[model samples]
Target: MTVADAAPMPAGPGEPGFAEAVHVFNSLAVPEPAAATTARTVEQVRSAIHHAARRGLAVRVHSTGHGAAAARPVRGALLIRTALDGAVEIDPRARVARVPAGTRWESVVRAAEPHGLTAAHGSSGTVGVVGYALAGGLSPYGRMVGLAANTVRAVDLVTADGRHRRVDAESDPELFWALRGGGGGFGVVTAIEFDLFPATTVITGAAYWPGALADRLLAAWLDWARDAPVIATTSVRVMNLPDFPDVPRELAGRTTFAVDGVVHADDPVSARRCADDLLGPLRAIGAPLLDSWQPDRPSAVLLAHMDPADPLPILGDHLLLDDLDAGGAARFLDVLGEGSGSPLVGAGLRQLGGAYATPSAPGGALDRLAAAYSYAGSGLAADPDAAAALRAHCATVRTALAPWDTGRVVPSFVEDFEQPQGHLDAERAAAVERVRAGVDPDGLFRQDASPTTTRQEKVP
Candidate 1:
């Protein structure tokens, strides 16, 4: 339902609701971020948060809320929007950026581009930078630079206890690690300072093929991508395109395979050579109807996947794999091929390992997420059951690949679950608890659905 349909709530400066909340976007019928919070400024944020805590209100912090859960707070909750509207500082000399909690990945990229630098941003620029890095951002540049969270220089946030704290590799090593991939279960981050790359652009884009070649194309892609260069960030997607005019005529109304490409920190000649060398096998497998894998501005890297710019309710399920060999390729086709059950709009296989699997610095928290290869589903219709079924299918795929499955899941793509934030398993759970106890003594930030201490039994 639209905000107009919901009952209006009294609000203050930062507390915009109904009318104001109408501008907030949720891919589903969920309330907008404006309706979720009643505060704007840092001081106002603190007051509203403390008031809610004293009154026993559940505090939820959101920016875009891309992976919002099935259940959400309605009363006595404070949603901070300050960071979303401000707090972006770029230091070219220091090669760092300090962004507010609400900053989107796209803005960070644009800001850094002028400085000949780039933040390791996700494919979907609409995602919040703080949220993404907090959950250990796995960006297109991830394979080359490692997870985004590992680049963090410092994090300024308020803990559950209503106290503000700055955490970094040096200040609070343990807490810093847990916050990296543990989600926001520890506290509400207001601002974050992280490293930036000296990259203005790259050779990036995508190539699409007809779905009938799903098996052939995937098999070829698997072989070619297995040993791809670290400079080339690639993904193979199985997409069920709608009959939208905006979609390429060849791909419209068809299930197509895309060999998405992104090349960074490489010369033009090396970049083109890398793309040709890596993708040549896929091209040889079948004639692509649409091939746009040419040089382009780095800022347009999102073109690799060509996802929609608007927000739409989405359900995603993911798992890490050890390999996607020829035999595994056949199985993947059978599960998500032309006419599979609960047909997904999009499916992606991202190669992992390389820089992704490298050991993190001495005390990095995100070093724990296991596995390099990750498979994810995107664009589920607004049907809950349909979404659930898609998730089930992904789980089945994971189980079938048990020997190759890493069991480690990225928080970014685990949104298909009833409670998306609860996917952090046993090992990640213990480390997260120590992070909370050490950094957020009062538990002011709402990182996950439930704090680490309360959900001890679920993991152990």
Candidate 2:
């Protein structure tokens, strides 16, 4: 029977009964799941997809819903909550982590800390391990390690066919490459095994400068970051802070400049030297609000970005540029730094070179792009304009940096696109189509009652 002709299925807990549905996270688009089912194991996850596909329902996966934009959840869909399945295993001998779909980066850090190991994950340890890795994850050691997807050893996924399969370089190579940067559209990734590093302490943290130095400081940051050593990674942030006693006294309710720093190496000594080179020029710009660049445990990974500990809906977007020279720096500061652009909670640019480009394996998604990745984000708010402003600012930065543009958009931050094509490759897009076809050939996975289009009809 056609998806349109298929009958409605039963709903699961917290979901509206088998009718029009919407996906909800802290913010962004909320679409419905394929159907309703409680899943805790790979078999169960597989069964749920089978049943939902039969009933003309769609399925979407969630891991803490960290990077989700308003557009993620599809209506009449099955929501797969990976966090509830929670399992994390670290293999010291192999320096690899066998983690479940629901696991968070923070869990991996804690598990590896006692063993003197660390995963080359992003600044937010609160993010889902699978979701982050799928996005060609950038790292503090990014210049040295490449994107997080580069370190992936294997993946356990429930494909479009309702079959549970393990994919690596040698097995299902095309699907494997798509998964690293293309994201969950291809299938429900239930578990992932990837490489980890040996380290107990890292020299990490950020420093805040007032907006007065926006011009000079940012120019200097761009220069230093380009030549940043393999051990270190940095980004610059410009925003106005709200006055909260909990917020650092110097930064509360004021225009500010921040240079986020990271040093993921064996000891604090080497880490510090790398961090100092990135920060030296900033000292000449403005008085710093906080300079907590010192040796700290891996568990304190959150300090690197100072991303909110509290869960709030977020809208994020990124760009990969060839360089952020003086003119490019001015445009960024003008659009997002001092007062030219709308209110944005956070905005920064990271230098991407070193190990990030030369992974032990080819960088599946990120390698397709040029070099130099820039990131921008904002807290969740009801106003769609906030999302628009964040996107507009990124566009300005992209245009200004077009001279050095390599044309790559990581999936994690590319959700808001009307049609997400530029951010992904044909093979990756084909993989998502294949997974959708194999798993939900009847078209139930689109969430819309219609389910007739190749691109699932999104429930607004």
Candidate 3:
């Protein structure tokens, strides 16, 4: 649809939903920033960036806040809230999509599903497409296709100098390379263009067992996952779901372990075969209380993980791990499984490798995740006491897994802006820094954002 067809949204602070707009999806309830502006069009974004630069004030850019820091990251600078006015446009012939920065993955999936095409979207449909794609997106198909940054074609941004430029490989080679994985150092991105794949469906879903069986199920899954095809991706999660009307009756207020996976293949028959092979071992541990694995649309994969639709008071931590042997898997389970009394709401291990371990041509600042798996855990922290306990427990979990730690961070998994991390090596990071200095000479963007910061975790 065209801009004329879309409804007009609020363009500034004090308008309806302005106060609610400052709240992120994580439900951190941070204090409002010093200055805030809403943008419904690209011109508005350009104006905000330009004005902030001249005023000598810092600027912070955000859309959905799905990956935003748990603490307040938007400070004294102007906060550019982009719910840009437009619909996603797809070109079936070219297998490309032009996504508005403020839009979510659900909108893009709906627009592309009819044509049997899909972008490399992250697991949550509610996540902002631009934020995920720009920060080196890790999708359900990451093993087969690689990070979403590998598919970027172009980006339209407003620089610190207030220049509006459409950059691609041929238009501006250096800027294009930096913007793909360099995060927000360059400028406020208004929109992006990316490649779409041919497959439209996936054989995917999740299977669950009681927490008592978490250890055995984890052991079986680790063995099976080792030989699983690159066309398949999976993760194992140990959860303590809350008792809420919205939650499934079987899962609510119960401790459970689940193995979720997806298989992307050319035909339904082949897809089912691959899924069966992946699920065979886990079934031996016990009959799962719930099993949703089956053939369906690619969008269905997003629902498999069962991430909360609304924001909650949450804090999280994650680490990358090298490939492990049978003994290593046992040690992992011993730390967080049965009788451990871990306070974490959910602790998960996502399988990684295949194409994700290999860099694609013209790779951006971050080309590959050097580890074979990712370990992530989080807890609800609604008050000071709960917050301190959650923070301390997260450290304990990390200490238990330090032996296999890769000592590197995954950009998309890191929501803590102050967390120490190294997403790239010294050489590539230096290159990205050079580009930032070139375009933003006055250091105006520095006041706005510093993705290069390796700030240590705060003592909350």
Candidate No. with top lDDT: 3
The top-ranked prediction according to TM-score is 3
Off by over 4 Å in 2: 1-25, 33-38, 70-73, 84-86, 267-269, 363-369, 384-405, 419-421, 425-460
Error at 383, model 2, angstroms: 3.8
TM-score of 2: 0.84
Q: What CA RMSD would candidate 3 show?
A: 3.6
Looking at model 1, residue 453 earns an lDDT score of: 21
Using lDDT, rank the candidates from best to worst.
3, 1, 2
Which run of 10 residues does model 2 get worst, by summed lDDT? 448-457
Q: Which regions of candidate 1 fall more than 4 Å away from where they truly are?
A: 1-26, 29-35, 70-77, 81-87, 359-363, 383-403, 419-428, 438-460
User: What order do candidates take by TM-score, descending?
Assistant: 3, 1, 2
Of the two candidates 1 and 2, the one with more favorable lDDT, higher being better, is 1
TM-score of each: 0.87, 0.84, 0.92
lDDT of all the models against the reference? Answer: 0.68, 0.65, 0.77
lDDT for each residue of candidate 2 in 1-460, tens digit (9 for 90 to 100): 3443232344654656422223334445544444544445666666666776676566666656655452434555666655335568989999999998878788888888888888878787777788788776777667767778888989998776777889988987766765677544666778899999877777777888888878888778777767777787777788666676678888887778887767775856667677677777678666687787777887776667887766555565555666766776776676676766545667667667777666655656444335676555454454777667666755665566567655555655553545222455455455455644554455543432111111432212
Which is the winner by lDDT between candidate 1 and candidate 3? 3
